[model samples]
Target: MDPAVARNLKRRVAAALHRQISDEQRATATDPDQAGLRQRGRALIEEEVARWSEDYSLAHGVPPTREQDRALAEAVYDLLFRAGRLQPYLDDPEVENIVANGCDDVWISRADEPLRRVPPIAESDDELVELLQDLARRHGGGERLLSTAHPTLALRLEGGMRLQALMAVTPRPYVAIRRHRVASATLGDMVRLGAVDATLAAFLAACIRARKNVMVTGTQGVGKTSLLRALAAEIPPHERIGTLETEYELWLHELGRLHQVVPMEAREGNGERGPDGRAAGEISIGDLIPHALRMTLNRIIVGEVRSSEVVPMLRVMTNGEGGSMCTLHARTPHMIVDRIAELCLEYGPRMTDALAYRLTANALDFVVHLTMVDETGVGGRRHRFVSHVLEVAGLGEGGRPAMNEVFAPRDGEPRGVPRTPPSCLDDLRRAGFDPRLLDSPHGSWSAPLQLQVDGRGPGRRPDPHANGREGGAR
Candidate 1:
């Protein structure tokens, strides 16, 4: 069926359904349940589609096929209750990113596959804007707005996908959706996916168990959030945790594995300024961090330390509980100290480079950096791996924090291998990390990673030592 025809039919049916529901609600004097509303909408969709099919048969001497009718109804239903034209892509488990430049230009990025263009989700730029506005009103507590005055929208969708949309500030309205493929992953799952070897996984799990404040750092789309989820999974189930984010990406509260999880998301304000010269009604991660501390959380996790949030987040790690964790954006492990200092400087006039470095040295125990190699342009796959893990020792020369490269990339290998023993090796041992596992320079990987460009299939080999056995001092 033609996309235009399907879109027209969807619009017509959606309008009719809206009217029908409104009239019913006015007659009943009460709102219908979601299931009841859906039932009525589906029935109306079938009736309208069947009538359209009959009229088209008489007009063109060929009726729309049964499959086309079914497709039309589903599309109408999606427009009414779901993500509309974008729902199919969101349903695809392998899809990692969705980018829309205006109404007709759409691109999709799937796991291990090259980027590809897809059909338009909206009929025009105006329609696309309307779709986004509707979505913002539906999700994220309906407080977000997208308009000429607002110009931008950022929120987490129903399936934990992060969405950012822009209008008025760009040549055309643009939107990007980032999907989390491994939202509920564990350290073992990371090993199976070849993100980390068995030895490195064991070491990271021990770090979590030993109540070390750690940070995961990497560039965009490098699996930093996924690795953070895996690390948080290492915490005992009974402990209470508080997660703070601009949007609900970590979704620890929904995991059901933790006994108690307090998930807090920051809110953007209305387009007016307050008496303090800040946006009216706006709430920031920095505001939420201290409030979370007062909640008596066993551990606090910030989804990402982007800017001013670094000040309070670092203080939490330094003075709060022992097992706090967060993610940061940095190019390399060695740059993490400088990055934190830079963020602190950006926060206000009070913070200095010396104070930032001092706070970092006392706050953080480990820095795990991830790296990604994208070869999809050459008919190869994208590989993301842990490349470095730096252990913070103390304040070093030149007002910077000193770091020991406990795990660094070996020659010709993207994954990290055990290098210098961590200064806190004894603490890791007490938390059940096997010191002998670090003896193997290969880090327990049975074979080197294979790539499609090397004329070999990118098949992951199982870790030889990935049995049920726990690694520790025993």
Candidate 2:
């Protein structure tokens, strides 16, 4: 087929589909009738395409090829059911993340591949903005807008993908679609993925069963949430679990093992100021914490602690029932005290550094630090693994957290030796876990830590600067 002819056909089909969609929207204006309206619109588009094809055949005295017809149909479908050019990437299960910079630039990261450029998702900046707006309106339950006034859009899509867009605030629209690949996972799955070894997996499961308060720490995009979700799966099937988040990231309610799951998401204000110049209708995680407590939750899971909410989260961890879990951003487990103290101090005036450190020490039991490491041989793809596991003993002499490094890999290896005895070994034993497992000087790894890309062993000492450690292993 001629390129000119194909382009013309595509334009015509897309135009017809767009017109049909508009007519359907208007016809169902107040009532919506989304399903019926979409059905009617698709039927109209097929009718129009059939008429156009017949007219072209009669005029040219030849039928279009199957390829041309298929192209025309796909063009119409793109305007109808799909999100224009982004539908293909969204359909791919392997795609882990999709990033769009304006309309012309698109990039995607796959589960098994590194970041790579992809075809444009929109023809122009305006089209890109419109697409994002449509996505927020359709999938986000019409709770958001992407305009100069709002200037931002954040929501979850129909396929459980999280979409965030920064528009008008930046030079061009920036959008990211984060796919939750580990929606339904278990501790065994983490072991299979090399995120943790079987020994650590068993230990984590025991901790969960023992109802230990756990916090997962890692740098951004290091799979902290993934590990948190896997740990959540370790909870017994009978216990009720509640999760609170800024966004609905932990899909624990969807897990099969858990029968009772209450999930709450924080909401951004409507960007409107009231008579007293106060933000209206804003709901924070702190606000939700008190409400979640009323539900008689067996455990509370805060998605990520980044603000004043740490105050309530800490109170719940210490004063409330055990088995609470949350994730926070920290480079290593040892830095958790300072990070929590900083967040509390930065977000609230009443919170003092002394109080923050005291609360963290009394409340949190364990911290698992996740990091991304390059694989040695097979392929050098960056893999996220559990690098360190530290037990929060108590406040030290200087008010810093006294951590027992239960697991620390030398040279970025996935496996590590157990440095300190678990504080909750008795609890773990009562929960039907083998207490002898904690006695092992070497961790559950059958072999030694050998995946270090630098060819370094556990005998190699870590860089002093990597973590803010003063003297040898406090």
Candidate 3:
């Protein structure tokens, strides 16, 4: 077929589809049938494809092959019902993230591959920004906008894809789409993924079942959210779980038929500051925490804690029912206490460091620290693993959080070992977990503290994972 004729046919088909969609919407305005509208739109696109393909074949003195027909249908369908130029990457199961750096330069991160460049998703920056704005309008409740006035848009699409865009805030319009790779994860599935060994998986599952307060700590893209989801699955089906997040990233409501889930997302005000210089109608995790608590929930899950919400989260974990979980960014397991203190002071109540330590010690029970290592030789991908599981022991000298190293990574091994007994021995047993697993010397691996390079030991050297491996995986 001729390229000029093909372009003309595409434009004509798109225009026809637009008109048909408008007509369908108008017809359905009084019906309140959303499924019917979608079905009509789909049928219209298909009928147009078949008619146009046949017309082109007859006029060009050639019959269209199966592949050509299929291609035409897909192209038309993308323009009609899907993200125009970015549909292919969205359909790929392995693509974990799609990053658009302006319009001409696009990149993607696959499950087992390094970040690599991809074909442009748009013809120009203006087109890219328009695409994002359209998405926000259609699927995101039309509350957020991407323009010089708002300059930022963040929302979850209908397909559960999390999108964040920056317009005038940056030199160029930037967009990022983070897809949840593991839609429905379980502890057993995570074990198969090499995220955690069978022992750790079993223990974490038991912890959840026993209604222990837990926090997953890690840097960015280290599978903290993944582990948190896997752990959340251990809660009994009869339990009512409430999840709160800045964006609805957990998708906990989709956790099958057994559990009752209440999902809440923080609403960003329309960038309107009132007389007090604060955005009016802005709702924070702090606001949602009390609301979730009043819902008679058996458990509460915060997708991630980034600010003053830590204060309310700690209060809930301590005073509210057990089994509350959240994730945060921290470099190491030991540093998480300090990290919580810093975030609380910055965003939450203006409390002294001593009060922060005391509150954490009383509220949080365990911290599961995760790390990602560049294992090109092993898997040709960055492998995220649980590096430490610390039990909060009372405040130690200088009001620092004292912790018991229950699980820590050892030399020459990817998984960490159980170094100490769990504080909740009776609870684990009641939850059907064998306490003997914690009693066994974990593979004869040396304790994490003793493995330090500067520590005195017979022939122990520094563990590379512990020594300045920051930014190892993104």
Candidate 4:
């Protein structure tokens, strides 16, 4: 009823409301009493607004009870700091990705199968933009709409998080956040999610520790990054690691390195960073690969080797100066090597067939093929997320690339685990694993019923119990 009292009420409600909004945006908890205060304060503002509207209507000789002007002012202030800005699941440790299809739809995926659609917390498009901008700033640099240029731009947040946002014309804007803290994921964590079992886990550890060059191939979001992160965790603590990525995605920096993770980011052009903060001059990742040679690093990691970077990466692998590891987007490990060969013709014209084969066999000591399989072979699979870890044996007579069925659960059933290829086991043995060592409790190659028969068709499953034939723990 009183104008002065209404003014005080508006100011108090706005301040408390703004603070509550800030807490929510930062993923922090707010006080319950604060909410109650906001409600009571708003009621006081509404009464004042009504008086203001009535007086104006009388002055204008119009009958009016609604305070449209005061209502507008209060609405602006209240909406500015709403709880719509907060996204708790984005910061959740279990959530791997946050996908949004415009302001109306949002979804999240965990390592385990379960894609859940979320309810819209934003009341309007402007509210959505406010929240997204705040998120961007907290992660690092915030996002904005460019009227002169493209209205959309994706970015990598500090500590290698991923963020994408789009400006809107009518409907709400779209935003998706992918937060991966490049930390070395533990094998136990992978096992818990069924990404890889114990036997394959041990084999992968040995492969990395032995300085074997490995190519991990998989489709996008098929846990390719997860598998890569898990393997990066396996890199020996004593060695130096150099990693190059389009955008820094690997967390190898925290691990051992004569130890350096040289992360190469993509510029506006199809090249890498320059000495300057801007992307004028393009520094190729292929060129950066050679720098690892001068660093005396034991292991070189390329976050994901694309076209031209592949050959140079392999060259370093074959030169005997370093072990190469990178993730590539592909359905199978066989396709990974093939793609590299095609890339070689593009990057390494001097490479011959024989030389390429020798170099490939020499450079790539192993290929860990990772693929996601649905739970139901036919349909109706709900919790249908499982990663199949396959290993590469070597070049077959096919002259293309050959893969050994190293790790796949039979009928997709969780059996004992999959056994390591005898080749890997033999290599481990020659490095001094006694034949009897496997029978000993803690032996690296020791595991029972882990290798299940494929029985899908005609195939030979290596007998880890027999002598090291294609058959031995020999």
Q: Put the candidates in lDDT order, highest first.
A: 1, 2, 3, 4
In the range 1-474, model 2's lDDT, one tens digit per residue, is 232343344456547656766786699765546676567556765666677678889999998776776666665555555566787788899898899888878999887677789877766788788777666666543366678988988888766778889987899999998887877778898887777877788888988888889999999778888889899988888888899987787888876678999989887777798896545787889899999999999999999998889889989999877999999999866677888998888656787888888898999898888987655234556677788888889888888778888888753445555667777778878887776665665555444433335456444445544544233321
Per-model tally of clashing residue pairs: 1, 0, 2, 4
* Off by more than 4 A, model 2: 1-37, 51-82, 275-279, 375-379, 410-414, 448-452, 455-474
RMSD of each: 4.8, 6.3, 6.1, 11.0
Pick out the ten consecutive residues of candidate 4 with the lowest summed lDDT: 139-148
The top-ranked prediction according to lDDT is: 1
lDDT of 4 by residue, 336-454 (tens): 66666766666656865655565576677666666654433332232212334444555678564555555544432433234334466776454443434323222233322222233
What's the ranking of the predictions by TM-score, best on top? 1, 2, 3, 4
Candidate 2 global TM-score:
0.84
Q: For each candidate, what is the lDDT?
A: 0.87, 0.77, 0.76, 0.56
- For candidate 4, list the clashing residue pairs, or say none: 240-257, 240-258, 467-472, 468-472
lDDT of 1 at 429: 99
Residue 151 in model 1: shift from native, Å?
Answer: 1.0
